[model samples]
Target: MGLPAMAIVLLMALLQTGTAAAETRAFSKARDAITEPSHAQYEYIVVGGGTAGCAIAATLSEHYKVLLLERGGTPYGNPSIERLEGWADLLRDDPTESSERSPIQAFRSADGVHNRRARVLGGGSAINAGFYNRASDAEVRAAGWKPKSVQEAYEWVEERIASPASLGPWQKALKNGLVQAGVTPDNGLTYEHIQGTKLGHSIFDAQGRRHTAADLLFSANDELLTVLTFASAQRIIFNVSDENKQPRATGVEYTDSRNATHFAYLQDGFQNEVILSAGALGSPQLLLLSGIGSCEHLAEFNITCHVDLSAVGAEMVDNPINAIVLVSPNPLETSLISVAGITHEGVVIEGASGGNWTWQWPGMGQLNIFPPLERSVEMISLVQTNLQNLSSNTKEQIDQSGFILSKVYDPISSGTLRLKSRDVSQNPYVKFNYYTHPRDVETCIRGVKYLHKLLQTPAFQGFRYTTVTPIIALLYPELSSSEGERTDGAYIPDLKNRTETANWCRDTVTTIWHFHGGCVLGKVVDKRYRVFGVRSLRVVDGSTFTKSPGTNPQATVMMLGRYVGVRMLKDRKIAEETVNSRN
Candidate 1:
């Protein structure tokens, strides 16, 4: 006799549960989290298991034992972070989620623009739109890095994380539109940051699965590397010399999830070092907290000053972005940044289309992805009156909309980072005075004009839903003198009038999330990336960059970690050989 229907159903459910248990998920706790207290010694202690942190640790682990301390947990098995489709959702802040465990930490800048930083193992690379492009040869030489070594470093990172992106419908259209707008010499598909329209490399695979800097850890000698996630580095442990009175970083003091403190130390060798790869904001913040920043500032917070480096949190900069949102007539593919139009005047154009547009402010005319804070009243009011017209649109129409954005290649205007609170978990206050420099305003104007040219291209006409009101045209209408539509069907007022263009640039300025500086090359660190007044301490991250490399800095940042680690190994080998021969 056959089994009863209910019995068959129960058996099927049991079988399914068994199969689920047997299957392994990718990147699910690939690196185990450390919850217990650890007091250990290693040849190298790298703070911040971020992009550079992971790379350097892996490279160093080949010969020396390394400890990589990350304040946040692993990105493994996080659906929101591991999938490209979850880009915006990954950035959106949830009030219910605690900052102590959130993969992305959202913070409001003093400039009134809201931004976010990574709090995961892979750092920004885990949360960012996975566009990968190499730095120009000029940038490599300017940084005083050897060309061959830089190439090798980049290749090492690329082989593990980056691959050629297969352009989706939206990116394909963007490529055609860019070329039609005279961004000529289409480089087809490439990883190099050349001047032209090209499809850059992506850390996302063909299946849209993201690969972050944490994956670089696979290169590490598993036995020699110890990655401690949920381990917040409180401060650097330094030992001052009695003879010279100079401080040398000896180890790092951190707290586990349970708030129990632990100390991780370096080995006895003089050459063994403590490196800070703790990002642009993080490295400086750690220095200040560790009593290595400005003496006056430290005293204000009741902290003793050790190094008195005034430039520790100076020269903060962010590339200002201005975007135009368009309602598309046809359904568009959801994609992260995959195409770039590089111009001669130091402006870059990139775009993305189709995602959950449910995150929006009423009458704000801006996606919540680039939401302005309450203090941004001027910016809010600038477009508030104009966006009221779209209040009646259905939610579905807004979902079909896409954006084309532009940014200045290298902005000159900058600000400083200061401590908001002494707490290690608190975000340091930073302001990037966007468009403050006259040249930056002009560069933005040039970039915006190119965006206009791109919209007028025939290739984009099919995708545009002109009848549904353009948010950009409504927000920043051309001045009366040039208010009329041209033959290309775009309002030329904002594009033709310098004053109007400048206003648009200022009013709508948002971050491309490419902020750099705070701990600059010559000011805070020497050519070797060592903190000037300290011994056996080095900072090797975006914090040391004079200017951001290429269209994005992720590739270069990862390469830098490997590059420096290899150099350190070579130098140590030479020193050891010399000592042996003399003996």
Candidate 2:
């Protein structure tokens, strides 16, 4: 025998861990969970090695020494994170697992709604649905970004993390349903943001593995890039200033794997800076913790105010989705589908087919999308052969295979994030305040109606056995005025689309996880993404987004990171030596 089975398994685990923990692991330790002593300093200290954090650090590392601090482990050896079918694994909350080490952090909003976010190196990209798309012209221009620069950034990101997705059987059916429902001119397969239905790209590779924002690091000058996993950034460290000089941020205080504390400082010259890309919730949390948020709230926590910026953790937006799970008679292939419906008002009816439905949602049948069929005495009597061998679990799994996750893109409802306490490891309070706006309620209704129309089409009916998701039908009773049936030439009236059922919208509305706008572009920071009243400090994540980007934020968030990185490279204040890091 080539080694014992248990021995082989142990050896393989060690090798996998070794590969992921090579250099970065050395920066952290485990005894009492403390970071070991080190004299190493970087030109830039990027906090929260997440989606934008990775992109910014990687881009800047092309010429400068960069230290990327992440609180979670590397994504390398995680089977649940690497495999396409493991999407839900990244979003699942295991309360039994400690927040400090868990890949998914569970959170509840002030409104009392709960959600989960990625705590791993790749951030949301490591846990999201992996649907990729470029930001619209309106969205890019909102930040006063040059189209060419933004375009270049988008291309750079695509080259590293994006691949054309091949439509599986379910995806093909979704495409047919969308087109048959008059989604638009049919843009076909693309990553561009066009006002028509199309099959976009995914972060998943043709090999069926996930390619997250962390993968962008490979494109960086590795010699200058240092990724420290399990390195939780506690707060931004700043240098004080005299009367004539503005205060500048010089470094960051972080805790490593061993819970050992460490400080990473910016170099003395060349305008060395500290960037905070710690995600929508994370970045704002860091800012507030560093005494950069509302002064009144800071006082309540017995923390001294620094910036007193009221908008640091305010003005958030997310796309409220209306998920409809349709049950099909035939079993479908397990893959990410890319069919979508686009409108000029920035409303998108996009969804994914439920592939890998069983593993992704083990108890999803409990949703009662379809009531299980009770066995009849006649059917039991008719079954004359193979009754003992039939797997009832497999049959139940097959019955729940069909799914359609419909979404209403770019909602108008804005939310906020606040700190629960001064403790660094503690999660901040979140309030999505979803569907408070009249427009958002209408959009949700319209999305539900549009999905209903899609279901009515003959192409979808050819395979779809019945409608299992009844929320849409409940929100607007007119879709069911005719028993939710697709009648020939029966167009749902415009009045139905504008239903004013506010409470239903609130109860049914939820985020697709594309949160933006906390430390806004101009209000919170300059277009260059610096925090006001702070020097050498910047927030370069979705937290800087001022409004809806009119699409999935993953790609746009990366592009913004790249765009801001280029500007930092060209900063006039940073001395030439400090800025140029070709060495």
Candidate 3:
């Protein structure tokens, strides 16, 4: 069976299940109740109604009163959100025109691909391509964490969501074609499996639904949890102790749809906790505005520093993914697959010195047939030296390198996130510093060459494939001649305009929108997900990821949110029980 047949079969199966899932009633009463502001004060305040925020709020409301603050208005049965196929179309439109819009606009990559980030009530999850990958055992072990730490929480989440490989005939054909190519399988289970192989189509729930965190959080019976849509937090109110003490976050001050400014504080007689789920961009900005960023930067803005942790906005990492889109001669489409489906065996030959080495590299060593140690050390030394040299300001040289490498490969550029201003309204300064590392350019170059090899395989030989990148054409017109050409088991001609190709690489290479490492774990925050130097405040979003997870981070974010929420709830129960014993 191929991809199209698999899709039809999957679609039919989903339609049946969807009928039952769709029949489940939404919270009509609560939806109506919160439309007006007369509702009672909530016990917990969850800022940013995004992936993690939604999950945290939903779980917390199960046992305690909760309030969810969303800057965007309610989706209110948006058809675009409920339907899976509708997402392909929705990605092409402006998010601002819809009920919600991401603060950062989706930018076109150098190769003319769009990179989108969601700023809606459900955050990126609502607008994302509904693909699911789980973290592999190696990934878990590499992070030096136990599965028990988050296993039960992940199991509970998986029960509600499913990833099934129900491919139709056409889909299966495509998968088989990929297999026929040198692409090999990866032996791990995780969302966004980036191990050398590509496998499995992303799975939707039985009801053909992409399970956003909002779906998990909102329940019909939870009247105590009040969801306030179209409400954005302007600032968090902190209680100053004496003249020289650290200010504590008590509550948040916000503005509602009516333009009315209102303050939500801890209840008169109860201890309240404020969790910032405002995402990597929003959370760091909120902290800076509330005076919790670097003391030097905050002082420049004439704000007193509450905490002077320099790591609050450092060591950012994101996967720089480049896509190779080909037009299949047959009407075939692509879907997510397991890593085992695509990783090539013996690709990393033993004793292969220089770049092919992987044995000593911790992240790459997990693969059984990786290169030997000496080669790995050589590659590491070369990469470090290249990075050190390129870190200096040499725009012309870097640009030249970016273009040359990008034409035939993928680049591994690194960047940083810095505070642009103290004002919460201002966006953070994101300097991608793309192509800053020489090794990144080398990696990208290697990746492109590898892609070319895959394209030459019998599976892709007859496809009406062309590089869709206009920049590639503009720079290397000779290469464009082969665009839309069928492979004839012969080497394609090199670009006639090498300088033009170099120029294109220098100018056109762009980012893959995997922003990470603002409030990194173990540095800015403790292992428990609580921000360092701040009492009773925690960050449970992408910012907590210590390093970029090397794939789409939606599943990891969801897992982290679930883990933190469950832990917090368990600890709270223990504390309450201890108090009861004393009483």
- Per-prediction RMSD in angstroms? 9.6, 10.3, 13.4
Report the lDDT tens digits of candidate 3 across residue range 227-261: 77767677766777754755667788776656666
Q: Which runs in model 2 stand beyond 4 Å of their true positions?
A: 1-39, 95-97, 241-244, 355-391, 394-400, 466-503, 572-583
Model 3: lDDT equals: 0.50
Please identify which of the two predictions, 1 or 3, would achieve the higher TM-score against the true structure.
1
* Candidates ranked, most accurate by TM-score first: 1, 2, 3
> Which ten contiguous residues of candidate 3 have the minimum total lDDT?
348-357
lDDT of model 3, residue 335: 28
Q: Assess every candidate by TM-score.
A: 0.88, 0.82, 0.72
TM-score attained by model 3 = 0.72
Candidate 2 clashes: the total is 9
Q: TM-score for model 2?
A: 0.82
lDDT of each: 0.77, 0.66, 0.50
Question: Candidate 2's error at 121, in angstroms?
Answer: 1.1
- The number of the candidate with the highest lDDT is 1
lDDT of 2 at 229: 80
Clash count for candidate 3 is: 48
